[model samples]
Target: MSELGKKIATRESYGNALVELGKEHEDLIVLDADLAGATKTGIFKKAFPERHWDIGIAEANMTGIAAGLATCGKVPFISSFAMFAAGRNYEQVRNSIGYPHLNVKIGATHAGISVGEDGATHQCLEDLALMRAIPGMVVLNPADDVEARAAVHAAYDHVGPVYLRFGRLAVPVFNDEATYRFEIGKGIVLKEGKDVSVFATGLCVNEAREAEKLLAADGIDAEIINIHTIKPLDEKLVLASAAKTGKVVTIEEHSVIGGLGSAVCDILSEKQPTKVMKIGINDVFGESGPALELIQKYGLDAQSIYEKVKAFVKQN
Candidate 1:
């Protein structure tokens, strides 16, 4: 949690990081499809007006422009809502960015079901699956403000097409910059236990931590792992934890169909077979409601995770 006892949205950290990065990297350019204010890219735009480009509301064109800028030795960070950046411009992103392996960073904000009152039209639940399917695309989902700030720097340092997912909701700041180190393709173990391993990403990571506490009270030691990177997952760490626990549980704000749950299942099934349980949206679209209430209704809350894990641990 933050020292001030207030939650901060990852998108806010991203906007602040971009301004700092702009001061250091002269070649860094930011592009937005007329959503600078909503996506928080307005902060970067204010800092670097000369380097920022507002390409109107055309997402596909904005992607192409970013790709062109990348080809000319410029590191372009394109910002938009997740639905527009990853959903509306999928084909352009696939061919213009992913296929060419361009050095473009897609800063997709308002991801998952946490975009309160926006309904399914604005909330993006399939971005992880969509981005993960692209070859050579590095997918990053930050769990807190600190991780989000670090992920922005990591994406800039990496020399390939990267998809950086951010959420609109303010989540708990669980990581300390002094001790916590963010690495691409690495999973951090927040807590260690013996009964079951809980793998989580993005907004669900904080909830998983709460679930860890609940499980501890019940004499169930649950190991909690924050999987910030969805692509090129930390297979070694996951396998090691699963080997010790023998049971696995995955939680994400996205759908269970092709999100973190699917990714973990694929790894466990291939390398070491383990009983796995998934807690997330069960192939249903989101409706307009309060973000916290929607999370509880969809069984993505900490209590729901604890109950599901208890059942899974008992059965397995």
Candidate 2:
């Protein structure tokens, strides 16, 4: 069955995981910057009203409070829009939570241009780059519902600061239920091939897999890698894949700069030399539209990836 027929999104899975977290840890505190409903933290608030905190519409203050809660031995999973969480709480995340190395988990939803119809104001195409730039922050971009649920637990278990970015739209779960497992810093190799290595994160990973299928039909062998963890980048696996493929196409919903594209190129530059074609939102603010249309307009959709892979296979 196609994953889309399953009808589940990573954001909804996060809501389910937060409820489980509150049940498991009495020290678990759920905080939202007035976006609990939209960010899917409303499920946590509904399940555990006492443990869930509505910190108004202030993202910065929410970060500060999460830091304070962390200092008191509480695991604060803060929720909000990715733009507000990453752009607004950047300094607080860098100095207070990260510099102090606190166990503060940030579950920022509505990441990427997937914040459809919300336009440039609410859409966050650069949040991944911003969060990944932090020194001690553990950056995550789960591919779908299964990985999103796993990431919640993974973030809960990790000792220091963690940032998880999830989409506002529904997507099919790409995780292989039997053998797949989520690790804090480990990447998943979903499909094995040598023609082109497509390393992708978040919802884009699903698109990359779809693109891989199309590439295979066109007599191309593409490796589809689910790079769930972006901060502690899996350089060894990526370098090995790049070395084997010689040609790479990085897919992300966020900007190419300082995001997955840059990270992959960094790995290739150090351990191997691979020709990388970066596919993502290229330094452009997203406009209000349907999510799929916005994806195509921004050149971050599966078709764009297919074309890039086709062009790359011809050259390399």
Candidate 3:
């Protein structure tokens, strides 16, 4: 495993990637809903003034414009908070982009309760479910800086609507930029073990790694796999891991109802029947608080995950 490196938010990586992609892919166009600053699309805006536009808080309108641009042979990327991009613009995205299968990339930043004190209105826990519900939509939730940037390139290469979820909180950069490989619909095994498989995504991946250490102290050998792509999930990898361990635990920052946990359950329940424990936000709304505090209070912190997994292993 690569050593843990500096912390960087995946949302920041999304913006930097757009600037680089714009330099190479001239057909690439960026559209923001008056949140270029927060979404970090302003970096692309400053670099390519003519190619980027602010739709002025009209997320649904921006979605339509992006779809129209896609039909005209332009690869348009729409940027906004996950709530507005995936939630508020669900209809436009489903009809305009998903229906025709347009090559439009949706960069939904500040997802999950990790958006800090932005509260429940801005924090989007249902984006994965919403995007996954759209037929032919490619859903991706990258784990770190390297994976996030690579996902942007992958989304551009994919010839259909893609939803990319990013976070506001800075997470540990554990993957080596030069050596790490990022592929859509593939999961990476960060650690190999035999007792149980701990599948994780987004910022929760780092916390899972930390929990792995605590689990080790208790003589629990937990396997860690980063499920970066939620939709088009790495079913083969998931089944292989579950077969090896006979037990599974899925961790994510979003709600357990329709996120990574649910996707994992859908696969394992059908092909490889195994014991599963889901660790994520319950079907409850988030409250205003510090990002780290919310994560802990909601029982997503490393210690909380460790305790829960330990109990699960002991009980089962």
Candidate 4:
């Protein structure tokens, strides 16, 4: 329970990191738009009551408040449901946080169709695309708890607007605290191979790993790259992986359009001419079910990756 364990959520990692980082950085402040409990920022509020602000349910005002605090040399981490933080407060985030490029960290929880049982409205599938469109926003979707904690530290040290996407449902904890390191605008080659590169983020990274095992068993070697930071995309690393593997596949719990897949295509179309494939949500809304069922239905699960990769390997 202390260190990395199986089937852990990123929210828990952020909850622990906020308390740990709050202890060292006195300037670290937290703002929650009535989602202190849900977003797991309540841990920080329990200790640093003075530094934590529960801004009611007004997400737009919360962004303005965070931006205002950033001007005074305070590094504020705003926590709320992803739909509210990124979907509802787009202008506030864009005009206030993104325009000035404030040192505000946004912990956008419950992203993608995996935010099941809450239905499509609550799930923020287009968050990465929205955040990526912002001029100075540094968008991130960590692979697991270890990367989640590490990204929190990196975001704290980073000076600018940061959008952190986390999941509501727990997945396999595939990383170790000691073995992993976080650097902004970089991708990690998890498993090296020469055929196809599976570039993924968020929970899809876990699915991609599982899919890799299936592919490897069939004698199809696949390279896996963890794209933690999406906005300042590591295009060079992506192109290099594509060049080395010669085939690219992107997996994400987001839309096929304007998400991780689109980001990878933007790079490969210019530098590498490798054939790329993507597995993600189509142009449709999510529904109520178990989180895993929703991901599987939306083609954001391991089976989808396996099918897509298998087809790609055959075509190649």
lDDT of each: 0.93, 0.87, 0.93, 0.88
The TM-score that candidate 2 achieves is 0.96
What is the TM-score of each predicted model, taking all chains together?
0.98, 0.96, 0.98, 0.97
Q: Assess the local accuracy of residue 89 in candidate 3 as a C-alpha lDDT between 0 and 100.
A: 94
Model 1 per-residue lDDT tens digits across residues 99-163: 99999999999998999899989888899999999999999999999999999999999999999
Candidate 2 ranges beyond 4 A from true positions: 1-4
Measured on C-alpha atoms, candidate 4 has an lDDT of 0.88
Residue pairs with backbone overlap in model 4: none
Please tell me which model should have the higher lDDT, number 1 or number 2.
1
lDDT of 3 by residue, 1-316 (tens): 2235888888889999999899999999999999999889999999999999899989999999999999899999999999999999999999999999999999999999999899999889999999998999999999888889999999998999999999999888988987988899999999999999999999999899999999999999999999999999999999999999998999999999988999999999999899999998899989888999999999999999999999988874
- Weakest 10 consecutive residues, lDDT, candidate 3? 1-10
Off by over 4 Å in 4: 1-5
Candidate no. 3 TM-score: 0.98
Task: Summarize candidate 4's per-residue lDDT along 87-204 as a digit string, tens digits.
Answer: 9989999999888888999999999898899998898889999999999889999978888988899999999989999999987787876667789999988999998888999898
Give the true-structure RMSD of model 4: 1.2
Q: How much is the lDDT of residue 58 in candidate 2?
A: 86
Weakest 10 consecutive residues of candidate 4 by summed lDDT = 1-10
